[model samples]
Target: MAVETGAGARAGMEAPALEGGAVLGSLLDLKADALGTYLRARQRHGDVVRIHVGPPGLRMDMYCVFSAEGAQQVLASESANYRKDNPFYEEIRESFGNGLLTAQDADYLRQRRLVQPLFTRRRVDGYAGAVAEETAGTLASWARARDAIVDVSDEMMHLALRAVSRILFGADADATTDVVHRCFPVITEYVLRRGYSPLNVPRTWPTPGNRRAAAAAEELYGVCDRIIAERRAGGDPAEDLLTLLAGAQSPDGEGFDTAELRDQVLIFLLAGHETTATSLAFTLHLLGRHPEEQARAREEVVRVLGDRTPEAADLDRLPYLTRVLKEAMRLYPAAPVFGRNAVAAGEIDGYAVPAGATVVLAPWVTHRHPRYWSDPDRFDPGRFTPEAEASRPRYAWFPFGGGPRACIGQHFSMLESVIALAMLLRAYEIEAVDTEVPLSAGMTLRAEGPMRCRIRPVRR
Candidate 1:
């Protein structure tokens, strides 16, 4: 989708356009190879490229903006000029209905405000014990297979699920976690595939993917409903996000209706676990490949906590691990591409943009732009040191995204990641099984196969 309109370049007033019939060819490239397609587009077409995407019979031209300046324009400076009207957001609502993610403007603000209190400093601090416990539990499992090659991706996914399940529901999630871990990905992958696919099939058509997604959703929703039902019946007697949510009143004073509560819970389950899992897997893979950084992080763990389990306060003390995680996210962001439909005709970074055109903001592309980082592909955590970070543009390295509509769970994600990574590194020495893991782009950036690593328990 690299657009090189030499004719338009001479005119100066017009944005470059993709040549004739290249749209279909570009569509094939995007579907078959997302990371390569975007990376190549940036290489060939500069930061701003025009491409067409949609079904075989129907297509809509969209701008793929790669520059940090363009990213700022769409996500921050003129954010109001854009809205979540894309197929991607609509499809997410299939499983995560009207949660903060798919909700727009006033509705999004309202929900964010309602849920914001759940992550207040004291409340967030309280979840540390549970997070550490789950980390220990996962480590226990890993210990049984010491020195064996393990799939870091699989282990991290389950660890994240168990931890988020406890934090979200505020109690034992053994049964619920099994159900969610079993079925949530089924629905999410289907929605993601449909949202990005060229042929837009209506979910009402009952195709195989749709049927599996629907069945998985029903089972997932039932688990949610059961949790709500149990809490109402005085089950567990614990105060968690669910407890407050169960009694949470709307801005107008009505507690959320059953459907409303369901939406919020479903979003937490999917967003809370899946994204963190992916990030952790990438973190481990990076650490496995970079042994020196791994050793430094391990040294910090020893100096800070010795043999004790990492507590909430221990997170801030491990600055280097934080940097390592941040750098991994820079290279392999969980949600690689985010789009907003233009609410009105506008110009972005000198390009004419029409109303309703999808403006794509890709961390996958911007995070690697040479102007923003020296040797952008290098795995250097020093890039995130305080002085180094302040030297860079704010929007240049957004893994969780930016502005008023930024990810609400970012604080929770960082805290959880710090805890999980610290605990894992403190316990094991990670050796890379392969020189590098192949990358793929989806709803999340993923390793195309198991990110295999050999783990040895720390002798100390």
Candidate 2:
């Protein structure tokens, strides 16, 4: 075979390129509407597109892959060639510490081995009682606001934070719930701004944004550290996630140190609540908008639970409701876009991908790909039916990502979300007050405006 290397391979690269010439090509569009920009790029440029951003000397290449096959390749098949060494991940590592989410190589392997046991189906299912208790509290609050508008986004955020905090810290949850709720928005917004910026002032600088974020980080980290210290002092053992995490030890007696524990706790606090909150809030919003689906889901909940509080075991029983949540995830994935850096030269869809370039995978786009979905934009829970799902590619709906580095909290997230949704639907009938929700792509997906819904007590 004839050789094609270097300039020859570069010239024959088959990917379509979108050039955003000079200082900031597509940067503004990305900042303003990341989801829209990515969707449009996919629609116009097909599954594989080479996007050019930044100015002359500092120009950057993003090999954007929107196909399900491409997602599987990058996230699973050829994962070794695509590592999480990109600027976005670097920012996350800097802010969150090298927890399981950002840990690489041997560090990731060790952490996963130790932490994997805590997130197994049986272990995570045990947290169902905590989820139900928190949901009941939220239901009580919603009952008080009967016939009034509630910001579903904020409400779900609070509900999820309380549930996860209680599970993670047990008695110490109260100390951090309000602090995390107050500080996360500021911290996440700061991360999004800095993570996407072509250039940034040092976080150590006393700029207003830097100072605000630093203060938030300090307060957040202090509370977690204090709690972890107290737990390590051989105090009364609480049956919480932290207790389990601290108790986790390897065959050689290795375990997470105090600092490592803090990093893991921080990542859990971020991923555990934030993603589930988004799922719950968006599911409610979608259900509220589509009353027929809402009625159907509620009907399923009633059929299955019959005025009883939902448990983890009930997750599979509530099939229709589960589908509703899945549909919501399809429309508004919590983590819309994630990136991986090419460790070496590769080809996606026959287009040459240069080493060191970032490959972006966006569930927000892939979920709606014309090839995979019949009515891409419409909200339909039936799409998740077992047979329907079987008809599509495996990577067509990867809300939690894929492969060895996939989210460890996947089952926990589902258990929490399904239980909470069952309870919420059983307790109240909600109608979306704000029909349209504008989104801001942050470290996670967020509603740019209030996702308000009017709720009335369900008449038995």
Candidate 3:
């Protein structure tokens, strides 16, 4: 059925469309190269594009909204009409549990209430010590490398995982960090494959993907469950995130049950580390690719702190470094694309959208929209300057998304990125050895190939 258009706007339009090509080809593109496919659609079909996938009887219609205004409507102004009922979210909730990221309605409200205080600006700022300690450890390991050529991506991943792990688990972090690092890829890959599959079989079936995902989920959940049990057994309580959750209660004095606790931990591990890791990795890689920007950022870092590590207070002082990180997020948002199910028919950018249609909001495309960004492909941190940013629509750069359902850990992610970047840049001079990073859009953005950079000790 054709989507009905608004009477006065873009009359008779059902959203511009891209040729779906062969059914098999469309399915393959959606599964394997969703980012590239979305980019092609946006470039060809303006902001509100209609995509038809699958055969006539079983087709799925995806309304791809790329304009900043359209994104605002879908994500913020009219967010209630868009819900986390899409197939992608279903796949995630199945594997990762109905935690904050995937929860809806009553569950979502309760989770948000219980978890909100833990991520507040004051509370998150208190975790800066963990960020600094982990960053210092990373720099020390880099100093040991004989050739000083490092996989910046891998290094940042480990550093971020360790940092957030410490903040979450405290003393038990040492044991959990390696397990999470090993299992997350397996689980996220499973989520990605199943999330995009047009037909998903039962997990009870012994398919290779299902078996791997099951094993990963088992190990991942087992670790969190064990840690939560230990914490709940009335041991010496530390000031970690896990402890906070263990003690957190709603107004009625209700707290998360064992299963709920595990779910929350799983989500924190996924969002807390993965998103920040992507941001840090890309920030460092972008710095490597742009030496002038790197040098300027390094100079600011040095001027701010000659030899001391950065704390939460230093974040505001490091303006140039913050811009660099923001620009990197603009180019490579960790959660590159997310989906919502339209609760009712609505017009987006003067194009009518039907109820129950899948809506895809792509930061990968919107961040590069030509109308909002001048020469969108360039690596220009200046685009994020206060004056320049104030000139654009609020949703023009929503790497962390917008509205009430926005990332709960946005403050924490920024704090981790700014600290990690400042500490690393102060210690090393980076140059891209493998400049072009082939990317894949998984649960988060991933560099499909190695992003290696050669680094030298910065002379005082």
Candidate 4:
């Protein structure tokens, strides 16, 4: 069935047709660089073009609406039509069960509300001291190997994972980091591979990647389960996110059972660390590429903190650092593209999209959309400056997305990035690698290889 266009003013843009098997094959063939291909196709075909990537007779509309109004509608006003429907979460559900990220509608809302206060302004602020101390300790370790060709991406991941573990679990958990690290690649690889493929395979089937992902997930869950069991046995209250959740009661007078608690804990541990780590790694890579930007960021940090550790209060004062991080995220959002399945027929920017259609809204595409931005490809932190920001409309720059389902960890991530960057800049001068490594977006947008940079200690 061809997509019926022109419900309103927008007409003549016909949806692409494909036989089901062929569509699935094409999706399976999509590489890590597939998003670039999608963006190019959208540039030629228009924002609301349709494509068939599932079994024959099953078609979906893919929207690359980069305009502020279009983004606002898809993410905010008309958002009810769109629900989280993607292979990523499907795989996650297969592995982690229905935790916060995998829960839908009422269950999702309930869990979000229960977890919301933990990420509140006051609560996130309390992590500042831990963030600073943890970051400083990581930097001290890194300084020992200043001249080593450090895989900064891996290093940042370690630092972020450790920091989040300390804040959330109140233990270093270094023994588990190796297992966690080993498991992460399996999950990430499976997600990237399956995300483009439209085939639905039963979890009971033993595909190599799927098996690895499941094993990895189980290992990670085992770690979380052990911690939960220990905490339960000891029955001590600690100042950590997990502790808060352990003590929290559901809004409707229900408390999380053991399995539910384990699921939430695993979700937070993985989601909390991976996304922020990727963002910080990319931010550092960008700074290395742009020396002037790094210098400006360092100057701002020094001016704000002046030899003192960064408190949460100092986050507002570090404008340039914020701008730099924002720009990096604009260029490379952690979760570059997200998909939604429209449960009801709706009109998005005059295009008639029917129910059961999968719609994709990509920050990768939107942030680089030529219509809404000036020199969209350029790494200009100024776009986030007060003057430039005032000129742009809301949803024009949404690395954290828009509307109610936006990243709940936005504040927490921002604060963490600021502290990490501030501490790093205070200790070392970072320079880019010899060649410019391009980005590949899987679960997160990361450099294809290790991002090697020269780091020299900065004498006070």
| Candidate 2 lDDT score at position 422 | 91
Per-residue CA lDDT of candidate 3, range 264-283, in tens?
88888898888898999999
Sort every candidate by TM-score, greatest first: 3, 2, 1, 4
C-alpha TM-score for every candidate: 0.93, 0.96, 0.97, 0.91
Question: Superposing all C-alpha atoms, what RMSD in Å does each candidate have to the true structure?
Answer: 3.6, 3.0, 2.9, 3.8
For model 2, what is the error of residue 277's alpha carbon versus the real structure, in angstroms, after optimal superposition?
A: 0.6
Screening candidate 3 with a backbone cut-off below 3 angstroms (N, C-alpha, C), the clashing residue pairs are none
Question: Which pairs of residues collide in model 2?
Answer: none
lDDT of 2 by residue, 1-460 (tens): 9887643465536688765646777777777788988898898888888777776666677888999998999999999899999988888887788999999999999999999999889988999999999999998888788457899999999999999999999998999999898887788878877777778889889999999989999999999998888889869579898988988999999999999999999999999998999999999999998999999998989999997878888987989998999999999999999999999987886678888988999999999999999889999999999999999999999999998889999998889999999998888899999999899778788898999999988988
Stretches off by above 4 angstroms in model 4 are 1-8, 11-29, 54-64, 146-148
- Which pairs of residues collide in model 1? 55-198
> Which scores better on TM-score, 1 or 4?
1
lDDT of 3: 0.89
